[model samples]
Target: MSAIEALYIFDEHNATILEHVYRGRPPTASVLLPLYLSHPSPQPSLIYLPNTHPPTLVYSIIQDRLLFLSPSSAESEPLLALEFLHRVADALEDFLGSPLLASKIESSYDVVAQLLSEMCDGGLVSNTEPNALRDVVEAPNWVKGLLGGVGLPSSSPSLNPSSQTPFSLPRPSLPRAPSAATANPVPWRRANVRHTSNELYVDIVETLSITLAPSGRPLSALAFGTVAFTAKVSGVPDLILQLNAPGGILNTISLPVFHPCVRLGRWKEKPGELSFVPPDGRFVLAGYEADLLGDDHLASFTSTSSTSKSLASLNLPATPAVSVSLGPTGADFEVRLSISPRFQNKPSASTASSSSRGGLGSRSASAFSATGTTAHPHIEEVKVHIPLPAAVRTIADLRTSRGDAQYAPGDTGIEWRVAAKDVAALLASHHGGSVSASATLRGSVVGEEEEDEETAPSVSLEAGSRWEYDEDEGGGYQTSSSVEPAQQRNGNGKGEAEAEQRSKRRVALNRVLMPSSATVSFSVKGWLASGIKVDALMVDAKRSKGLGAGVTPYKGVKYLTVSRKGVEARC
Candidate 1:
C-alpha cells in the first residue's frame, strides 16, 4: 500500500518549522527547498524530484503562510497524499483555533505530537475526521496553563489529558473514559453521545458557473451543489431526506457522490431519497452536478413560437447582461451591466395549484404538519470586471448608478462592486416586484489623436449640406465656397496617416479597448436556481440502531447559491 514517508512544514521564509519522519529516509527540507525555489512560482500540487536517489514525489499545499510538503518514495495516489496534508492542516486549526498561527504550534507541542500520532498509524492514514479526533485528542487551553504555573489545577480537565502539556496546571487524577473507537463500532461517531436539546440542521448550497452569448442564448450553464448536515441528536439516528425538482430527479441531477455513512441501495431505489446514519456534528452528506442549460427547456413541448422561447428564457438562472457602446468619437466608450433577480415573486406550479384550492397550508394540511414558506435566493456581492486594451492610455469619467467603481491610471481593467443589500432594498421599494438594477461605466480612451481625421470626410459632408440649405433659403450664412473648402482641405491633409490610424483604431477597439467578455461574481442565500426543494426529513424508527424510544429532534433547513467568478457574458 502507498504510505507517507515524511511530512515537513516550512514557514514563509523557507525555514523548516516542523518535520516528522514516518518511514523511509526522505530528503531534508534544505535539499527540497532549493529545488522547489528553482522552479517558477505557484508550483503544481504534485512535483517529481527525479534528481533524488529514488525519484520522490513531493505533494505540497500552502495554507496560512505555511508550506506543507509530503514526500513519498514509492508509487502513491496523488490525491491521497494531498488530502492527507489537508487533513493535517484542518486538525491543527481545529485544536489551536482558526488561522493556525506559528505561535500556537510552538506553544502546544505536546498536543501536536498526540494529534500527529493519532491521525497517522505507521505511515498509513487513520483518524483524520475532526469530530472523531476531538473525542480522543484533548486540546490545550491557555486558562489551564496559567493555573499550572502557580501549582494549582483547574476545575475541568483538558479533552486529551493523557498527554503532558507545557505550563498546564496540576490536576487530581480522575478515571479516564473508555476510548470511543472501542466503545462504538463506527469510529466516526462517539458512543453514548448525549444532548439536552436535540437539533438537526441541513444547509444546501449551489454554485452557478454560467456563460451567456451576446445574442442572449446560453452557451454554457451549470450548477455545482453540496449538502451539509449537522446532527446533534442524542443517539445514532437513521434519517431519510427527500428532494423534489420540477424536471424529475434523474433527468435533473448527474454525477452524484455521497458520504460513507449514506446507504447506496436506498439512493439507487429512489434517486432523490438519501437514507443514512449521520455522524455527530457537521459533515458533507452528499454532492451533485447539475446541467442548468439542458434542464431549463421542456422536452415534451417543442414549440417554434416566440412566446414559448421567451417563457423558457425566464426560467433560466439570472446572468448579468453586458453591453458596450462607443461614443460619437470612437475614443470614448460606455459599458452597461444589468442584474435581474431570478426568483422574485415567481410562484412554482405546485404553489400556484395549492393556492387556487385555498392557499398552500390548507391544501397540504393533511400531508405535512406545517406548510413552509418559499423564500427566493438572496443574491449579493455583485462584482463585474472589464479589461481594457494596452494601447489605451487613460480611463476617466467613471460613473455608476449603484455601488462604488474604481479604475487607476495604470490598471488594465475596471472593477465595479455592488452590495447585495442594496439590490434587495431596490426590489423591496418596488413592492415585492421583480426589479433590475443596472450599473453604467463610461470612460474616455486616449490613443493617437490623428485617428479622428478618418471621420473628417463625414464631418465635411454635413457642413456642405448645411451650406446648401442656407443658400436655398437665401439666409445670411457662410457660402459653400468658404465652408466646404476648409472642411475638405482639413480632411485631405492626413489621408495616409488617417487611414493607418483608422486601421490601428479598428485593431485597438475590436481587439483591445472593447470588452470581449465580462466576469461576474455574486452569492445568493436561501435559494436554488434549479428550483430543487427538500420535501421532508424522517427518522426510520424500525431500521435505526442504538436509539431510545419517543425521542424527537428539532430540525431546520437552509439553502444558498454562490457564484464566485462563475458567471461570464461576452459583450
Candidate 2:
C-alpha cells in the first residue's frame, strides 16, 4: 500500500495551485482545506481528520509562503510522509531557484509534474536527491529552443554528409546513454565531480542562550552548535573528522544529530569520530547541543560562596551588565560590557609579523588555524539592547565610552553598538597590557509627564477658629487663620516628614522608567564557549575513489559563536 495518497499545494491566498494524486482514494482539496484551516494557527504538521471516508492524516509545511499538504489514509511511517513533503519543497526550490514563487510553479507545471512523478513512484519515494534527479529529468534549455525554431536539429549529427549516401534512409534515433549520477550507488552525491581547486572547509557555529539572575548568577546556559562541511574535489571522497573537548566530547555535547551520509556505526563506536561521504557542495554535517553550565559548574553556582568567581571561570569572550540609577530628576541607566583577558591579549609573534608584511603574500600565513591554537580571537559585532517600559516617553542624553548609542522616539528600546576596531583599540590603550577592558553606555530615560490637578481649598474650624489653607503654584501651603495660634501649628517636624514622603514618591516614580532587562548580541570568531575544537580532518584514500594520487586538498576549519540578543540580564 502507498504511504502518501495525494499532494496539494496552496498559494498565500489559500487558493489551490496544484494537486496530484499518487495512489489510493483521498479527500479532495475543497474538503481538506477547510478542515486544515479550521485548526488555530501555528497548526501542527500532522493532523487527523476522522470525518473522511477512510480517515485521513494531513501533514503540512509552509515554505516561501507556499503551503505543501500531504494526506495519507493508510497505516505507514509518519516520518516517511513528512520527510517526503520536505523533499518535494526542496526539489522545487532547487529547480525553480530560491523563494519558490506561485507564478514560477504555474509557468513550469510541466517540469514540476515530472519532478513530482520521478521523486515518488506510486506513493513510495524513488529518487529525491537533486543531483541524481538532474540526470534523469532534462531541464529546459534555451539553446535547444533557438535551434529548433530555425528548422535545425537540436543536436549535431554524428555522421558526416560525405559518408551518407544520397538515397540512404534516415538513421534510427539511438537511445540516450544513462548518466553516471543515475548509475552510481551513492544516492546523495553526483558522480564524476571535478573541480579546478580542491578545498575542504569545516565551519562550527554555536549560538548562546544564557539567562542570568539580577545577582549575576547564571540560571541557565545552552549552546546550539552546527557543523557545516564543504567539499570541492574531483570524484568521490570519503572523509573522517575527529572532534575533542576539554571535558570529554561525549559529556560536552548532548542530543547530537548527523546527516544521512554520516556513518552511525562509526560514531556509535567512537563518540567524537565522524565518517561520511560528503555531498558535492556545502551541507550541514552534524548538530548538537551543549550545556555551558555542567555539573561541576552548576555545583559551584549553587554554593553561595564566590558566585562571581565561578562565572569568571566560564571564560566568556564578553559579558554584559545593566544598572539603573534613580534620582529626583529622572532615571539614568548604564550598560557595561567587559571583554575577557583572553581576547584582549596581543597576537602571537607569528601572526603579528605576518600582518606587518601586508600583502597577498601573507594570506596563507594569516589564515586562522583550524584548532585556533595560535590565532588571537577577537570580539566583533557587539550590540546591547535595553528594552524599556511603555511608560518611558523617550531616551535622552545618550552617551557611550567607546561606541554609539541610538534611540528613536517611538522605539521601545535603545541600541548601543561597538565595532571590533574600537574594542581592539580599547584593549590596546590599557596602561598595562594583558588586562580585560570594558565599555560603558549611559542614557537617561524621560517618562511621560503627568499633569497636576488643582483641588478645592480646605476650611477647618478648630476651637472656634476658622482656618483656610490653599496650595500655591510653588507647591507650598498658604494659610489664612482667624486666630494667630493656629498659624504656629505648622512646625519643623511636620515639614521634614512631608519632605521625606515627597522624596520617596519621586524614587517610586523613577522606578517605573527603569528597564527590566538588557540583552547582548555579538559574534566571536576563533573561539567557542563550549571549548570544542576540531582535532583532525583526514581523507581516507583506501576507501575513496576518483581522487588523484598525492593530491592534498586544502583543509580549513573556523569556529564562531553568535548571540542574537540571546544573553539576557534581568533587573
lDDT, each prediction = 0.69, 0.77
- Tens-digit lDDT track for model 1 on 309-400? 54264343345555554654455566565566454333334432432211112223232222323444445567878777676556657777
Model 1: lDDT equals 0.69
Model 2 spans > 4 angstroms off: 1-86, 99-107, 121-126, 140-182, 344-374, 432-435, 448-496
How much is the lDDT of residue 396 in candidate 2?
A: 79
Q: What's the number of clashes in each of the models? A: 3, 0
Consecutive 10-residue window with the lowest summed lDDT within model 2: 354-363
TM-score, one value per model: 0.77, 0.77
What TM-score does prediction 1 earn? 0.77
Cα RMSDs of all predictions?
9.6, 6.9
Query: Which residue runs does candidate 1 get wrong by more than 4 Å?
Result: 142-182, 295-318, 341-373, 389-392, 428-437, 447-511, 543-548
